[model samples]
Target: MNTQIQRNYEAAKQIYANLGIDTEKAIVKLKDIKISMHCWQGDDVRGFLNKDQDLTGGISVTGNYPGAARTPEELRQDLEKAYSLIPGKHKLNLHAIYADTDEKIDLDEIEPRHYEKWVQWAKKQGLGLDFNPTCFSHPKSDDGFTLSHPNKEIRDFWIEHCKRARKVGEYFGKETGQPCVTNVWIPDGFKDQPVDRLGPRERLQASLDEVFKEEINPAYNLDAIESKLFGIGSESYVVGSHEFYMGYGLTRNKLICLDAGHFHPTEVVSNKLSALSLFSEGMLLHVSRPVRWDSDHVVTMDDETLAIARELVVHNLISKTHIGLDFFDASINRVAAWVIGTRNMLKALLRAMLEPTESLKEAELRGDYTTRLALMEELKSYPFGAVWDYYCESSNVPVREDWLKEVKDYETNVLLKRD
Candidate 1:
C-alpha cells in the first residue's frame, strides 16, 4: 500500500464522516456496480463482418488513428489491456457485427454460436456481456431505414436479426450468470420531412411488436429499446424519437435506453431518469458526451454525467438502472478512450454514493433550500480525488493520470505494431 494514498484516504474519510457519509461504504458500493463498456470504441465501430464498408446510417467515426483493431482477436486484445487499467470488474457491450465466428453470415443469419468465443473469453476474464443488434451499416439500411423501412422484405430482415440477437443475449446471461440486456436501436427516418410521419412510426411499432413476440426468461435476458432524436441521414426526421420509445417501452414492458448523445443539446438525459423511473421497471443509460449533436465524443467527468450518477444514487435507482458507455474517438488511443470514459463513470458513481444525501433530502423536505444549496457548494471542495486514488490503489490499478503511461506503453508495443 502506498503511504501517501493511505494518509490521504484517512484524512478524507474523516471529512466525509463529519457529514454522516461513509467513504468506505461508498467504495464498496462502487465496486459492485458494473458499467458495460462498449466494444465499438476499440475499432471505430467497424466490426469484423465487413471491415472495408463505409459506415452507413447517421453515425460517423471521424478519426483515422493508426492501429484500429482489424479482427476480433485484436479487438479483444485491446479490450483486455483496457480492462487492466480501469478499476473494478465490468461487462463488455458487444455489437452483432463483432461476432467471433468465421461464418459467411449476414445480419439476419447470425446466431448465438457466432458469439461463443466472446462468451468463453468473458467467463475467463470473470466479466459479463451485453448485446446489441446491428440495425445500421448494412446495405438494406443504406437508405437510412431498418425496422421501419417501407419494404416488407427489408423490415423482416432486421426483425429476424433482432430476434436472434436476443438468443445471443440469453446465451451470454446463462453462461456468465449475469442477465444480459439486448438493446435495439434503429436509424429509420427520412432526410427531409415526409408527408406522413405516423405511418413510419406505426410500422416501426408493429415491427418492434413482432420482434419482441418471443418471450425469453427475464432471469437470463432483458430487452431494451433505444430512441434517438435525430441522426446523420435522418436529421430532418428520426422515426425512433424519444417519445416513440417511451410509449413503446411502457406498453411493452421493456427497458427504455436513454442515450446521452441521442437527445437534443438542451435536453439532458439525467433530468429524465427520475421521471421515467417512477413508471418504467428499469432503464439502460448510454453515458456519452455530445458537442452539439451526436458526435459520440469520449466521456469526461462533466456536469451531466455527474447529475446522472447523482440521480441514480439519490432516487435509489441503481438496482434498476443499467449503465453502459457509448462513445468512440478514433483520433486518440482507442484503448485509452475505454479506460478514461469508464473510469470517469465509476468515479461519478462513487462521488454520488459519497454524498450526504440523507441530510440533503431532509433539508429539501423541510424547505431549507439555502442549507441544501450551501452544503452542496461546500461539498464541491471535498477530498474526492484522495479517496478515488486510494480506491484505485487498493484495486491494483494505476491512480490518476498514472494510467496514461501504461496506455502509451501499450500503444508503442502493441497498437503501433499493428499498423
Candidate 2:
C-alpha cells in the first residue's frame, strides 16, 4: 500500500476508536464513505482531487445546465476529467442531464447530447455513466408533469422523453461498465381542487410503467429509477412531504432516492429517521442544509441537524445510500458553498458514528427510538430555540463559533439550564 493511503487508514482507525466502533467493522463500514461531484467542482471533477482531501472515489455528474458541453471537444474533455478523478479504488457515478428549471423551465432548449460520443469517450477512460431523464416541457405540463396533468398528450410527451433518455442510457450501460440511472423529480400536485382526484398518481405510475416496459426490460438491466421532489415554485406548485410517501408506495422500483434538504425547514420537523421511513429501501441520499425555508442552502449540517441525522444512519434505518450533495446556494461564493457542504456531510457521518449509550434493541424495547431520540424535540416545555441550542451544545463538534454563539444567546435568555 502507498504510504499516504496507510496514513489515512491510521487516521480513520483512530476516529473509529473514539466512536467506539470495532476496528474490523469500522474498516468495512468506513469504505462506504461517498460524496457527490457537485460539492467539489460540478463537472470539473478532476480539478478537485488531491492527497489532502480523500475523494470517496464516487461522483454524481450534474445535468448539463451550467456545465453543458459547449462543443464536442468540451464533452470529451469533461469525460476525461471525470475519469481521472475516480479515486484509485472507487467508481465514479456519471449522471445524465435533467431538465433545467432555474430559468423558465425549458426542456426542448436542453436536449441531451448523443450517447455515441459519451460512450466512446467513457469506454476509453474505463469510466461509468448514469442517465437522468426528465420532462418538464410540454405546455400541458406547465402546471405539473407525470402526476398532476390530466391530458394524455402531456403524458405521452413525458413517456417520449423517457424513451429518448433510456435509449441513450441503454447504450451507455452496454458500452460503459456502470448501470444507467433514470432519475425524475416531478413537480406534480394540486394547488386548488378538482381536475381529477387520481390524476397525479395515475399519470406518474403510467409514465414509469411505460419506461420500465419499453426501455429498462429490453436492455436486460435494472439500474436505479429515482423519483425526486420539489424545485422552487409557487405555493400552488409545491407538494407536501406526503408526496414522497405516495411516490415510493405506488412505484415498484426497489431503490429510492431521498433529497434531505428538499424537505426544507420541515426537515427540522420530520427528522432523519422519519424521512428514511418513507421508503424501506434507499439507493441515494441528497445531503444539504436548508434555512429560512430555502431548498439550496448548501450549507453543511449544523451541529444540531447532524446529531439527529446520524442517529438515523447508525440505527440501520437507512443503508446503501450515496450522498448527492444536493445544494444550490446561489448567494454564497460558488466554490465556498460546495466546500462547506461537502465538509459538513463528512463531519455529520463521522459524528453519527458516535456510539450509542444503549443498543438499538434496548432503545426500541423501551420505546425511545424515533421521536424520543431527537433530544431537541423532547424538551417541549423549553422554548423551541433554547431546546434547539441544547441539542447543538451536546453534539460535541469542535468548531462551531458562529452557530454556537447565536444559539447560546437564545439558550441563556430562553431556557433555564439544569444545574
The TM-scores of all predictions, comma-separated, are 0.99, 0.59
The lDDT of each candidate is 0.93, 0.45
Give the clashing pairs for model 1: none
Per-residue C-alpha lDDT of model 1 across residues 260-304, encoded as one tens digit per residue: 999878999999999999999799999999987789998999999
lDDT of 2 by residue, 1-419 (tens): 33543454456556546535444453244345545434123323322112122211111223322333333354344433432322222223443332212333233233334445555655776555555554333354555545335677766766666666666666666666555544554556544544554546655666666655663652323334443333533233343234544465335644455555555454442254455555544555555555544344564567544654465555554344545555544343333344455546554554454344345446668897683466334322222222122222333321234433433443344222311
Identify the candidate with maximal TM-score: 1
Displacement of residue 344 (Cα, Å) in model 1 is 0.4
Looking at model 2, the pairs that clash are 147-200, 185-228
User: Where does model 1 exceed 4 Å of error?
Assistant: none
